[model samples]
Target: MKTDSTDDPRTDVQTASDPCQTNRDHVEYVGMHVDDRPVVLNLTEHERLAPDRSLDLIRQSRPGFEWGDTGSGSAQLACGLLLDYTDDEAVASQHYIQFRDDVVSQLECSGPANCWHLTGDDIEAALASVTGHEALTPDGGTPTPSLPVNWSAVNRSERTVFQRRDIDHYVVLGEGTEEWLLLLCAQGDRAYPAPLDIRTVPIEEDPAPAVRELVAESNDLVEPEENA
Candidate 1:
């Protein structure tokens, strides 16, 4: 009695020489972090996708791609992976950030030689896990409106102000009778409109340490103009 080829387990495996498998879409991605740099390869195409290509499609929040943390680098990596995997700009733009926060941030490599792998099916499943409420628009806007802050309502006294000698940028730290506020402002001149950045912390028993820390962290604050 002869056995059927259809019933053979060896026939189930796909090889590069198989004509039926040759035309199939490439779905496998391999990622590695080597020498403090990230590398991603499309195994099917036998080509590497540059991180810069992804940054070109989206505004770069970080200098480069990274994973295993919920930082700008991880976000960049997430965006790049989606764009590379789907080859759809709109799909990548709309879903990348959420995907970064959910999946990419959790990818960890314990050792230097360890590499990560992802498939088209894995990407699809991750995308599907994104809830409707977490989706962003193609333009990257959230559906909900941000509550407006009224700066005039706060009763604050200027504790100290740092002004950049070369420009109109200022970092001001203020103290209310009950709380503390920090304001970073760029005063507008003929070329541009004024923009304000504000941060606040509630008053604890002692505000000295908090004020000193805020002052230390304001890198934009430079030495004040002499005598003025």
Candidate 2:
């Protein structure tokens, strides 16, 4: 269930010639696929704005979002309201399909719809402002990191942030009965590679506090580093 973060194209820039290749500039995205490639809604512009009540809060700041006729439906899904429980299934199903198609069309018109397509330097600036974690490529999106000096890190070899490997939303995304009705990924999308993994990697959870508790207990949860 847990996919390696390094498998992601955006996070994994390493090559056979450059294993130590550091992540240069990562722009976080909340997107889906179009035409067998990733069609991203680059969220770099809306880094300052929180998705409190509405995804609409950041639509204007997005890199390129074509608010087509079905744009309102996409917005509705993003805000966690697809349809009422009492609403008829046939109508909801039809609406859902149309909304996803509109998103795909809009994405294609926005820019080159590719997974590794970096938006530009402007996005990098926005990322620089919000990336709180030290390790960027694979860990830039990690919500929290333990203090290096903390005792919980006694077992750690290199400085590392806990990778967010848990993803529950995909289960919901695939489920026809889930409250959230946005079909961000199709069945084909899951087979591509690490983009699905990267998208699912949970970024919101903070691991520092729990790790701190283990430190207090003198429990080294991880293998100790070999002495240099």
Candidate 3:
């Protein structure tokens, strides 16, 4: 089910005084309650804004987008917005969860008839505030990391199958009974011995290729000093 200006009375026309007003270059995302269900639309595209499933490689958190609270639905919405706004999977993946908590969850609606709107600039500012980094451009030089890696710790039982130490980062591949855990850590004390990012591959598969890809794409790895 799609909602657009031509079909939805709530979004039929934009008022000149509306704060959500946008230009051709500015994309405006609108979310509202339709029959008690949430409906999101990209005002610039004039189409329904659906959640991006590709961001859910680790797990399917929710089937669609939602707002006004921090939950699986909000997480999905956050990922979708970041992906749509930045057009950069790496930037979206790195900060979507934080964006969800900082922005999406705060999009409170008064009732079923209530609505919220966010411009591309608003999203950019929110992302910057949440990540404490500069906004990402469409061509933001940060190369996309090889695969989705979770921010988690490694289990003590896992055996280190591969290890790589660089001037700034430490990467480890740990073999478990059913999976190979790939962990990237900082070189110094701030987060050393604890993974800043993690990826899991099935036990039946080889982890060497993944390790190589990750190492080659290590420029974006978070540094311990930066976090300290």
CA RMSD for every model? 15.6, 22.5, 11.2
lDDT of 2 by residue, 123-183 (tens): 3332344333332112343333442232211112433322222221111111122122211
Candidate that scores best on lDDT:
3
Q: lDDT tens string, model 3, 1-228?
A: 666655453543355555554456888987877766788878898777776553453132545778887776787788888888787888776677678778988996543335688888899788768667432111222232332232122233434422332244545776676677887665565654666678898643435556655655564553323322
Work out the TM-score per prediction. 0.48, 0.20, 0.52
**Ranking under TM-score, best-scoring first?**
3, 1, 2
Of the candidates numbered 1 and 2, which has the greater lDDT value? 1
Q: In terms of TM-score, which candidate is strongest?
A: 3
Instruction: Estimate the overall C-alpha local distance difference test score of candidate 1.
Output: 0.57
The weakest ten consecutive residues by lDDT in model 3 span 135-144
Clashing pairs in 1: none
lDDT scores in order: 0.57, 0.30, 0.62
> What TM-score does model 2 achieve against the real structure?
0.20
TM-score quality measure for candidate 1: 0.48
* For model 1, the run of ten residues with the poorest summed lDDT: 144-153
> Candidates sorted by lDDT, descending order?
3, 1, 2
Q: Candidate 3, which segments miss by more than 4 Å at Cα?
A: 1-9, 12-19, 52-60, 110-113, 133-228
